[model samples]
Target chain A: MTSALSAEGLHTYYGKSHILHGVSLEVAEGRITALLGRNGAGKTTTLRSLMGLTQAREGKITIFGEDTTRWPTFRIAAHGVGYVPEGRRIFANLSVEENLKVPLERGGPWTIERIYKLFPRLAERKQNRGRQLSGGEQEMLSIARALLLNPRLLILDEPSQGLAPLIVREVFRIVQQMKAEGISVLLVEQNARMSLEIADDAYVLDDGAVVYSGTARELAADDARVRALAGASAEEWTLT
Target chain B: MMTQLLLFNVTNGLIIGAFYVLMALGLSLILNLSNVINFAHGGFLVIGGYIAYTITPYIGFWGALLLAPPLTAIIGLAVERVLIRPLYGRDPLYSLLLTFGLAFMIEDGTRFIWGPQGKPVTIPAFLAQPLSNDLFFITGYRLFMVVVVMIAVALLFLLLRYTRLGVRIRAGTLDLETVAALGINVGMLRSLNFAVGIFLAGLSGVLAAGQLGLEPTMGTGLLMPSFIAIIVGGIGSLPGTLIGGLLIGVASGVTAVFFPAASEAVIYVMMAVILLTRPRGLFGEEGMMS
Candidate 1:
């Protein structure tokens, strides 16, 4: 299958510190690709580089055959790449409706009504400002806003971070729905077990490099090896 | 006698109050959209008054009124593109300092061009007549200013509340980053907003020339009072700025009538008292550093 998004030898920096050292990965079209890593594993940095939020020192990042390594964030977004940064950075002063409207793409299937149907809570609190919404509502709004762009590839940076279990489940459900609709996703998740369960392909990023890559089922079956590579406690695997 | 004096004070108050509202509204719009205090706002006003003065002799009063604001707006656009645009995402204090320096330059530039002597601009012959009754008398020029400002304020309020561009501006003011993400060119929107703000300041300055003498330093006098209005009204709220302006205008008018010696100091005193009681001013947001 043709890769919808591909990065080869990507090098990114924050100020003088080199955070992503020669990272490389590929996201197949119409599949849920999970990038699993522990804290400081460069998962967020990879997403940022892909979205052009941070400048990549050396690398070729292609989105649907177009090189976008040096493009600005706004231009990158215009090329059908939607980004949800790690923290739910919803505009605090804008109403839920306004927040959704602010990033409304000119022509797309993800209208306000469609997003409302997908996340009922957002519709219910459409008039409420960002500060008034609960954590789960904010996350849902963030995803809903990105989805409204009808992006060819959705890059979510730790969407489950701080979300309640029920909300996290809902987020995973949305990911499955996206996969079914043939939209590619690059999900960065710290929760290895849940992410592996939903993801079609899994990549283990450690020390700013892709240490392991395989089918999600293969990664799931090798419990001992996956745990050792992921550095997750035995309790975390058992919980799943 | 006291009742008669009170009536006079109230009339004077309304006139001055309306003028403050006009000036403060312009300042608030720029502050909300650009997130800059624009210390050079007063300079725009000074330039605007000069524009009117320069053209009034040739184009007549109505033509001068129309010509002054757009000219000032173009100058404002130049200021934003040349100076303000380069300093975005940096500390707000830097912009403040830069604009402060610009204000000094503008004031001095006007002095060099127009000279230090203040020039009194006479009201046009058509508006110089006074409408008087036994109890109350109003100058036609002052009344015309009040009416014109009221119309402008109403139009501004309508534009901000309605219209597609206005909607985008309102959204941008609340959160600029999100607006940009939506594919709206935030830089362009900011430039347009800066131009509109300068236009308003220039409009106010032209109207003010009819009331007071035109001098390079006239804008300097208006700056502190306009700022006080903004602080008291709330930094970003339009209606709040209006109220703040009117409040200062009336208080100053009344002080001038009753306590002539302390009239100049009254606004500062009132500001101090308001700060002591409600640091955010009457309508200001809680915890807003400005």
Candidate 2:
């Protein structure tokens, strides 16, 4: 399958600290790819670099056969890469509907009605300000806002970072729906079990380098290796 | 006797209150949208007053009123492009300092050009007539100023509430990065907001020139009162600014009548009291547009 987004030898920095050390990954067209890593393992940095939120010191980021490594975040977004940043940076003063309205490009497949249908709770809380929403609601709003851009590739950084188990399940359900809709997704997740369960392919990142890249089934079958890399607990290993 | 004093104060209050609202509204718009506390706003007012004084002799007061705002808008746009744009993403205090310096520069520049002595500007003869036979007689020129200011306030309210550009501006003020990420050119929106804000400042200056003495230092006197109005009104809320202006205007007018020595102190005293009570001022949201 043709890759929707490919990053080659990406290097990134914050101030003077180097965060992404020549990391490389590919997100295939119409598939969910999970990038799993521990805290401080450069997962969010990778997503941010792709979105041009953090300038890449050295790399080539090709989106749909166009080199977009030097482009600004706005230009990169216009090229059909939607990013749901970590911590759900929703505009607090704006109502949920208004927050969603901010990212509505001139023409896109996703409309307000469609996003509402995708997450009914969001529709119910549409008139509420972003600050008034629960963490789960804010996450839903973030996802809904990004999807409204009708991007060819969706990049989510830690969507379940602070969510409860039920909300995490809901997020996974939405990811499944996105995958079914034929849109590519790059998921940066610490919840390896849930990510591996839903993802078509998985890349295991450690110390800002891709340690493993293969089908999710293959990664899951190597229980010893997965445990070694992830330090998975007994409960996590038994998760079906 | 008390009733007469109250009536006089109320009329005077409304006139001054309207002027404060016009000036503070312009400052609030620029503050909210661009995150710039423009000390140079007073400079724009000086420019407007100068432009009106220069042109009123040839084209008359109406033409001066029509031409001054656009000229100030051009000056505003130039300032934004040259000084303000480079300071974006840096500390906001830097921009404040830069604008303060600009204010000083503008004040001295005006003095050098217009001379230190105040210049007199006449109210057009048509508006010099008295309106009523009673002691509450209103000059046509003051009435004209009132009407023009009200019309401007109404138009601004409608523009912010109903127009597409208003929607974009409000959205940008709330969350600039989100607006830009959505493909809206935030830079252009900011520039437009700056221009509109300075235009309003110029309009207020023109109105003031007709009533008050026109001089290089005239803007300096109005600056403190306008700032007080902004603080009393919420920083970004237009209606809040208007109410704040009215409250300060009336308070000062009443103080002048009852305790003439403390007239100027009334606004500061009110500001101090409000700051103690609400900290965010009336109608101001906590941590808004920060």
Tens digit per residue, CA lDDT, model 2, A1-240: 899999999998899998888999999999999998777889988888888778789989998898989987778887787778899888787678877767747476799998999889988998888899999999999888888888888899889878877888888888888888888999988777778889999998878888889998999788876666466322242223
Q: What tens digits encode model 1's per-residue C-alpha lDDT throughout B65-134? A: 9999999999999999999999877888989999999999999999999998997776777677766664
lDDT of 1 by residue, A180-231 (tens): 8888999998778888888999898888888888898898898876676557
Q: What share of the true interface contacts does candidate 2 keep?
A: 0.33
How displaced is residue B200 in candidate 2, in Å?
Answer: 2.1
Candidate 2 chain A: worst-modelled 10 consecutive residues by lDDT: A231-240
Q: Which stretches of candidate 1 lie over 4 Å from their true place?
A: A225-240, B54-60, B63-67, B111-127, B134-137, B154-175, B286-290
Considering only chain A, what is the TM-score of each predicted structure? 0.94, 0.94
Structure candidate 1, residue pairs in collision: none
Error in Å for residue B44 of model 2:
1.0
- In candidate 1 the C-alpha lDDT for residue B36 amounts to 86
